[model samples]
Target: MPISHIEHYNLRAERSMLETLRDFYVTVVGLQVGYRPLSSYGYWLYAGERALLHLSEARPGDPREPHLRSTFDHVAFACTDLPACEAHLRNHGIDYRYAEVPATGQRQLFFSDPAGNGIELNFAATPDS
Candidate 1:
C-alpha cells in the first residue's frame, strides 16, 4: 500500500515558550492535546488521527546554528476555503502576508506563531479544476 499522509509535526521553541505555543495551538488554531508519553512533557495535538502537532522543548544553544534554520522557515496547512481562513486569522489577531502562485494557481498567506515559527494558510484555485 502507498503511504497515507503526515501523521504529526514536532516543533521546537525555547523551553520557556511552551505555554504560549500551546495556547496558540489550542485556542487560536483549534487543536486538542492528545495522549502524552511518560518521558516527555510535550503533548500531541490532534486535528485528526493522521494530523497532529507535537511541541518539544528546545535545548540551549546558539540560535544561529544551521540545523535550526530548516525548522525555522515555515510549515504550510491547507485551508478549507480562503475567506473563512482569512477571517479566522484576523479574528485571532494574527498578521499575515498574502501571495498568489500563478503557475499552480494557489493562494497562500504566511504568518507566525507566538514563538515566531512560520505558518502558511493555503487554498486551491477552484472547486473542480
Candidate 2:
C-alpha cells in the first residue's frame, strides 16, 4: 500500500534543552502527548498517532549541534479558516508574512516555529461558496 502521511520525526537535542523544546511543541504547537518510554535522558513525544517527535539525548561525543542555518526553511499546513488562523498567530505574538499564489488565488502566510523552523499556513480562496 502507498504511504498515507508522515508518521513521525526524530530530533537530537541536548538533555538540558529537551524540556524547553518539549514545552514549545506541546503548549505552543498544540500537539498532545501519547506515551513515553523510560530513557536515560530525553523523551519521545506523541501527538495523537504514533510518536511524532522522538527527542534523543545528546552525548558528550555527539557532533550534531543546533545551528540557525541548519533548520528547515518551511513546512506548510492547510487551514480551513484563514481569519481564525491569522488571529491565533497574532494573539500569540508570532510574526508572519502574507502572500497570494497568483494563478490559484490561494492565500498563504509564512511564520516561524519556536525553534526558528519556517512554517507556511495556507487557505484556498472561493468567491462566495
**Largest lDDT belongs to which candidate?**
1
- Per candidate, the number of residue pairs that clash is 0, 0
Which number leads on TM-score?
A: 1
Instruction: Tell me how many residue pairs clash in candidate 2.
Output: 0
The lDDT of each candidate is 0.74, 0.71
lDDT over C-alpha atoms for residue 15 of model 1: 52
Error of 2 at 72 (Å): 3.0
Residues 1-129, model 1: lDDT tens digits: 798887677876665577678888888676888776747566677776644788776666824221334535887787667888788889988888999998988999998877667878788888553
Candidate 1 Cα lDDT to native? 0.74
Candidate 2, residue 46: Cα displacement in angstroms equals 4.8
Q: Which ten residues in a row have the lowest lDDT in candidate 2?
A: 63-72
